[model samples]
Target: MYQLPFTTVVESATSNTKKLELVVHPSVSSKFKRYLDIVGSLVGLLVLAILFIPIAIAIKIDSPGPIFFTQQRYGLQGRPFRIRKFRSMVTDAERLKSLVSNEANGLIFKNKNDFRVTKIGRFLRSTSLDELPQFWNVLVGEMSLVGTRPPTADEVMHYNQRHWQRLNVKPGLTGEWQVNGRSRVKDFEQIVDLDLQYQKKWYPLYDILLIAKTFYVIFGRIGAC
Candidate 1:
């Protein structure tokens, strides 16, 4: 494996070392990181701007509510950030969530034919068009073009210390789990494992590969919703 500029020691003389570990600065990959986020997001947002009009019209005709759905999710270092997505469910879906959450995988809540999903919601989710607003997050430096998926507050609370390493880099709009098997894979630990793989082996080339794979997955419409 390659080493970063600084060597991270587990502890100094005053404290006992639990396990020695190396920590890399997020800035190590800063240049390409910013480039991809800015350029890619800008292009993506432009495309979505063109596409959003039609989607918004469809959503409005299918349901009654605002055009967007904003929810709080944890970003790098467990920081709180609001993730924006097009509204895919009824306005009252959150209120009705608890009652219908019983069928969830215990870690992630998923229902293919969920009652909360509007006619347009199902298609948006299947096509992943609902996630287009996250490009705004990428443009603003809140997220990355490729990295670990951001976790919700509830998901973060359940995370263990080791799992926190996912926050070493900016969260992504698409990630290993999304491409690998999102709804099909329900093991939260396995998701963290994939995140750790990305963190430990991250490189500009790896990111490019993941991005290409993501595009394939998106257009292929595999493992979606």
Candidate 2:
């Protein structure tokens, strides 16, 4: 029997320690990349300040909760961090998710239309405006401008060995999955595959390309939300 770092018992008796260990690579510890996140996030925060006011106002008028939404998410090395986003859904959205979720494709729940999403939430999600506040997370070193998508604690709990590999580096607001076609790919396993692909190939040039493609995705409004 093999003991695991996360728990006393493994998820499967046949699970291979070598395969699980392979998920975390040594190159994940990149000091220069962390520095880049700080500088880039600060610059992004400065630019987003202009739109913050109007977006905040819209959210205030549309809902009664706090202006920002904060939740626990896994960061570099599977550490927990409070990731912030603009409030796009109603305060009770999480509580109502089970009822509103359309179906589960493996670990993720998807719904083209969810009832708990406020009017402002709909627009924010569609434009990816809800994610603006994550720049602060990036600045503080909890995330990156471009990397694997962060999974919530609940999501992480559901992750198998391959999916946990995403946490080898800082999570990002945009990544290969976001620019590739976010809404079109609803399968949870496929999302995990993309994250693994990112972990194996992170570099400054790749980050730059991801950022450029992200801009195009944002402007082109293709498969967002």
TM-scores, each model vs. reference: 0.86, 0.85
- The global Cα lDDT (0 to 1) of model 1 is 0.77
Q: How close is candidate 2 to the true structure, as a TM-score?
A: 0.85
Instruction: Write one digit per residue (lDDT tens) for candidate 1, span 39-118.
Output: 99999999898998999999999999999999998776666789889999999998998767444454567776689999
lDDT, candidate 2, 4-92, per-residue tens: 13422244222232213323443346676677777888888986798899989999999998999888876765677787788878898
Maximum-TM-score candidate = 1
Candidate 1 deviant stretches above 4 angstroms = 2-28, 102-106
Each candidate's clash count: 0, 0
In model 2, what are the clashing residue pairs, if there are any? none
Give, for candidate 1, the lowest lDDT window spanning 10 residues.
11-20
Best by lDDT: 1
